[model samples]
Target: MTVTEQTFWVVIPAAGVGSRMQADCPKQYLELQGKTVLEQTLAHFTHHPRIHGIVVAIAEDDDVWPTLKVNTDKPLYTVNGGAERCHSVLNALNFLKDKTRDSDWVLVHDAARPCLRREDLDKLMITMAQHPQGGILAVPVRDTLKRVDVACIIEDTVDRERLCHALTPQMFHIGMLREALEKAIDEGVLVTDEASAMEHAGYSPLVVEGHGDNIKITRPEDLALADFYLASISDEAASDYDGLMADDG
Candidate 1:
């Protein structure tokens, strides 16, 4: 389908305090390459021609959002978020109930994951077109994983095969996702992400392969990593442009 013909919306959950980052502001508000992490994250969807609109769930007392300048032509809506990430995502979904159709795609992305590549996002949109239950952008686990105990001792070495690190922009039908999240919450199932909620409802979400660099900025160290990834992406784009110029010459 053409870019303008594609119909999908994005929901970003930016409510968390991000205590793990140990930052003065939420991790999403932390500076990355001059702009806040949330700003960079929003740019991905906002720039994509396929995206119809975006809903951001922020804290009720958030004063920083008003200060930060984000430029986008797409319709942006903000809602009061709940106590946790799942609640915030649910709130955004509820905001879309009357605005979107039941079959329209909704992508739930983390506000701190600013390094989501355009190629990966494109791949996700294409892959989910045929997926009834929808899918997520994830990378297969590469390292030897360990099942650890509370004492910080390794209990056993877990098999790496069939294990994938779940990433964001988890795409699903707005109606299906809202229903999944509502049912999961009603059953007291604490879903960490949209795919988990779908899984709890007995629906298998697809795993579309993505790069490992689609990292979520959780700790202070992750900011550095995200900066590195962003720089690398810029360098790659420049290289491609130079190659095209040389080919024309």
Candidate 2:
């Protein structure tokens, strides 16, 4: 299917306080390349032709959101989020119920992940065309794993062959995701992401291999890493544009 043939929506759960980052504001509201992290994250979808709308779940007392100067032509909605990431996503899904069709695809992304490459997003969309159950962008574990005890002692070495680090932009049908999340919540199941919720509902989500640079900003050091990735992306785009202009000349 072509990009124009399908409508895509995005839900960003930006309610987390990001205690690990130790920032004065939420990590999503932190400054990155002159714009807030949330603004940069929103840019990935806002400019995409295939994306129809976006919903962001923020804290009930989130005063920072109103201060951000986010500019986007696409319709953007904000809802009050819950305490946890799953709750925030579920609330966003609930808000989209009245605005979107049940069959429409929804891509749940991390607000702190600002370095998501456009190619990864394209790859995910292409892969999802063949995946009715939906999928997420992930990278295989390359390092040796370890199972540790509470005492900081290594218990056992885990096999890395079957393991993959899950990333955001987890795609699923709006209705299916909503139902899965709701059921998980009602059953007292812990769902860290959309794929986990789907898995709990007995649905196997596909994993589309993506770049490791698509990292979520969790720690203070992660901000520097994100800045580096964003700079690299900008440089790549500039080089591509210069090449095109030179070819034209």
Candidate 1 residue lDDT tens string, 1-249? 332345799999998899999989999999999999999999887766668999999999999998977788899999999987889999998999999998889999999999988778777887786678898999999999999999999999999989999999999999999999999999999999999999998899999999999999999999999999998886332233233222223
Q: Tell me the spans in candidate 1 whose CA falls farther than 4 Å from its real position.
A: 1-6, 235-249
lDDT of 2: 0.88
Q: List the residue pairs that clash in candidate 2.
A: none
TM-score of each prediction: 0.92, 0.93
- Candidate 1 is scored at a TM of 0.92
Q: Model 2: what TM-score?
A: 0.93
Top candidate (TM-score): 2
Clashing pairs in 1: none
lDDT of 1: 0.87
